[model samples]
Target chain A: MNEALTLLSFGEHGWGDTIAIGALVTVSLALASLPFGLALGFLLALAKKSAEPSLKLAANIYTTIFRGLPELLTLFLVYFGVQIGFQKALKLIGIETYFEVNSFVAGMFALSFVFSSYASEAFLSAFRGIPQGQFEGGQALGLSRKQTMTFIILPQLVRLALPALGNLWLILLKETALVSTIGLADLMREAGIAARVTKEAFLFFGVACLIYLILAIISSTGLARLERWSKRGDTAR
Target chain B: MTVVSSDTALPPPPPLPRRWTKARILGHVLMALWIVSGASLLFYLVTNINSPFVQKYWPDYVDGFLVTLQIVSVSLLIGALLSLPIAAARASRWKVLSAPAYAYVYFFRGTPLLAQTFLVYYGAGGFRTELEAIGLWTFFREAWYCVIFTFSLNTSAYQAEILRGAILNVPKGQWEGAAALGLSQPVTFFKVILPQALMVALRPYGNEIILMIKGSAIASIVTVFDLMGETRRAYSRTYDFQAYIWAAVIYLMMVETLRRVWDRLEMRLTRHLKR
Candidate 1:
């Protein structure tokens, strides 16, 4: 027990600080991807619901491919495939310079792709939950379409979409661990280093799991509270 | 009955006005840009055959594909079996039975599969001597076995939840009707309720199976030569992007095929319910 404590201590001999930084990376990755992902997801939802058949079909195909593919594969594709493609494009444009995509950027791009695909589904359902009359009512107010979306529809959409999106956030938090494979010093990777060096694989891995569990618990409770707050206006309509 | 049809039929409802909505305009611009840029991407991938990449790694990719299939299928089979009792316990009236079941599900569902896998695979090393003494080291020592073990446990939780929900949704009347018929509880569950519950679970089961297929890629990380593992080897050898793209194509095809097959299976199973 004392050995375990000393091994995890924050000093030169200990690995606590490294693991703490990893946890921060994990949280930051998830947080940083949120706005971009949400924006893309909203656009995807719009495309899927659009009157244009081709647009809808394209959106469907995009979501299907993104969601069905493994996150690991997606990460690798962004890491390797995008780099190669980008280089080739640059070459074609008459510029030649050796470049590499950062692992963090690749991870973010892949996570956003996956996140948006799932989020689009939630957004689509939320859009459905609103009555058509809501849109018509917006028009009745002589509000421009964009104005109506910003002032009226979006607030309601956020409420209806909150539970599903909140669940996705939990999924995303865990998914950040995948970035560790690409060499991001995330929680999993830090523990991995600690385990390898100390030969206490169980202790370190167990600690990692505990940290993830705590984060998941905290997120769930926060989301539950947010759900209630979002539904404050909801009643026996 | 209406002889004035041709002349009086309200002047073919004045052709609806083209709104030229902002969204439509944006969609058009996006379409044009994609047609120029994204279309080229699709064209290149579909037509540009990297023969050397394919010829060199095709066999390896095939082997990896089989391994992936074997992992997903074997683990899912075991997971389904494990989930049966778990689902029962979760549905049980006894707090003792249900509470542990709930905790098991929550822990597995809460954490990432990769970490659970690391815990099982490397954590086994921490207990090498104990495992060896118990004659279980041989099993735990194999990366393949560890992966299957972790996957089975992870998937079992999801399967259990699906089953518990399905069983609960079987309706109060079925249980009452079975009891009124003098059918014992176990017999009723086995003969009547289970079949109905299974039908309700069919779609979710299909989804779980697809998820397992996608997830099996992680098995490669532990040195199991699964599809992703094979792709990684190919990319390392050539530094070619086509290897990963091809793997993605294969995965997409597998998922699409299963989706269609599942749809057909669902329709066939529920044929009686159709009008």
Candidate 2:
């Protein structure tokens, strides 16, 4: 009991600070990927809406491939895969340097890429949910297609896309833990390390879960507020 | 814009009008990231072909992939079997039986899979002495057993919801008709309700099976030599990160195959509904 308490303590020797930083890094990674993922998702939604066979097929294959694979598998692919590219480029430049791909970058790239595939499906449905008549109205106003898409089509799509996007983000946040497999000292990894050293897996894991739950609660609240804000624009219609 | 407007007036775009426009070319260029990422992974493994890393660990990755496939297939089979009874209980009229089943589904679904996996695995470890006293430690001690136990329980909750939703989607008239024929409650469920519900449920179950294939990789943490486990081992021994890339390639191929099967199944199931 004493040993467990000391291990969990916030002293210089204790891992409390390290674990806290890990939690911070996890949050930062999720936030950084959010906008990029949204953009990727929007493109995917557009591609899915394509009338052409090959374009539609391409979008279908993209979502199907990413959605079917495991998050950790994707992470491993991105982690080492990027390293291979860097090494090849270095060789081409006649530099023998071994370029290290850091864990933070790897985690960010992998999570965002995977999150976009799911988000694309969400956004595509949201786009489909809008009545065809609204677009007709946009055209009736003499607005160009691009203007109609930007001003009329997208804002409403965002509103419709919010709930599913929120759920995807929640799943994405929890999945950041997989980054630890590549030696990233994220919240789960830190907790695992502490658990290993002390052999008190329960205590550290409990703390890790508590942190994740708190993160989930906070993000859900923020999303609720955003949803409310998006709804305000619906009143203009 | 003119083409789009004309096409809109005609109801649906023309069959094939040079699908790859410049905008689409740009879109494809951007999405080249995924293909590039996948290609980079392949390059990593191939370049490291003659490295000691590949020589020592290539067999391990193959063995690990087999184990992962085995674990995922078994868990999906068992989990789907178990979920039927639980779904029935939840959908049943008895509050005593239904409430507990509902709570179990809710709790498991609400939490992340990783936490639940650890809770079951480590929690079992914590209670080993007590379990031994009760003569259950033998079963709990094996890594494979623990992995199966955790995965089966985890998937059962998700599958219960899928089944319950499908079952409820069955028309109430089926029950009335069954009763008009003097069928028993069990007979109505098994014969009438289940068959219809299964058509709805099977597609989602396929989705769940694909998900389980992914989730089984988590078992690597518990010393189970799944594909991910082998990758981790190779990286640790050789410090050649490409080993992990090979594992990921294998996983991607397996998942892509499952996705094709799922798409076909969904297409067949919904064919009658389509125009």
Candidate 3:
């Protein structure tokens, strides 16, 4: 017991601090990607709904390609392919500056790209679910198109989209672990390093799994509360 | 009044002038640029495939594809079998039977599969002594078995939930009718409920298969020479970025094919309900 405690203790020799920091990195990665993904998803949903054939096709292709590919492959493409492509493009444009696509950035790009595809689907369905009368009613009340969207449409869309978005959030949190494959010092990577160093793979990995479960449980509870809050108006109706 | 009608006829609506709006023009330009970039990227990939390195490594990728198929099929078969009892337990009236099953599903679904894989693969090393004593050390030590073990367990949780949902989705009327016929509980479930529940489950089962195909890519990290593993190997040897693209294409093909087949299967299974 004493030895195990020493192994997990935070100090110059122990990995407790490192693993904690890794957990923080994991959280930040998820948070950083969430808004970017949501914005892209909103845009994609709009594009898909647009009258223009080209715009709709573009959005369709984007979602299909991203959604069809595995997340790890996407990460590799961004981490290696995009970095090289960017540098090459810069050179052609007479720029001598060097740019590196770090694992965190690559992971963020890949995950957000994946998240946006699914989110767009969720948003599209939610948009379809809104009653046509709501829009007509807003117009009948003399509300402009923009006003109708903001006051009448967006709120209801949020309520409709919340559950699917919550599921995506949970998935995004889990996907942060994939960044470890690209050498990001996220929770899994930190656990791996510690395990290798201490020759205690079971203990470190067990700890890592526990940390992930705790995070998952906390997020799920929060999501449930959010769901209830979003649906509060339903009970009154 | 009749003479005034011709002159007041709105002048043929001025031919509905074809003025371009700023937003319309911008949308068109953005769409064109997107298409151009996408086409050029594909063009580059197609033209670059003539490399000698790609030719030499093509066989390795084919072998890796087979390995990936093998892993996914085996694990899914085992997972489907294991999910049956667990799903039963999850839906049982007895709390003693249900709680542990619920916990298993919750934990496995809540956390990432990668973490679970690591725990099983690396963590099993700690149990080398006990595993050896049970004559299972050889299986536990190999990365292949570790991946299969982890994947089967992980997928069982998901499959169990799918099964439970399908079972619950059966109409209450069906159960009542079965009971009215004086059928035994097990008989009602097996004869009446199970077939209909299975029909409902077909789509989700197909979805699970697709997810497993994608998830199995993680096995490459554990040194399983799956498709992704071979991609990494090829990339290291030739420094060819296109190697990853090739693997992605293959995965995309497999997923798309599976999706279409699954859709057809669902339609066939549920055809009676359709008009």
Best by DockQ: 1
Which residue pairs collide in model 1, if any? none
> Model 2 lDDT vs. the true structure?
0.82
DockQ of model 3 vs. true complex: 0.62
Top lDDT hit:
1
Candidate 1 chain A weakest ten by summed lDDT: A52-61
CA lDDT, every model vs. true structure = 0.91, 0.82, 0.90
Q: Count clashes in each candidate, considering only residues at least 3 apart in sequence or on different chains.
A: 0, 0, 0
Which sequence of candidate numbers ranks them by lDDT, best first?
1, 3, 2
How do the candidates rank by DockQ, highest first?
Answer: 1, 3, 2
How would the docking of model 3 be graded? medium
The candidate that achieves the highest TM-score relative to the unseen native structure: 1
DockQ computed for model 1 against the true two-chain complex using alpha carbons: 0.65
Residue pairs with backbone atoms closer than 3 Å in model 3 (clashes) = none
Looking at model 2, the pairs that clash are none
| Per-model root-mean-square deviation over C-alphas | 2.5, 5.8, 4.5
Segments in model 3 whose C-alpha atoms lie over 4 Å from true places: A93-99, B1-34
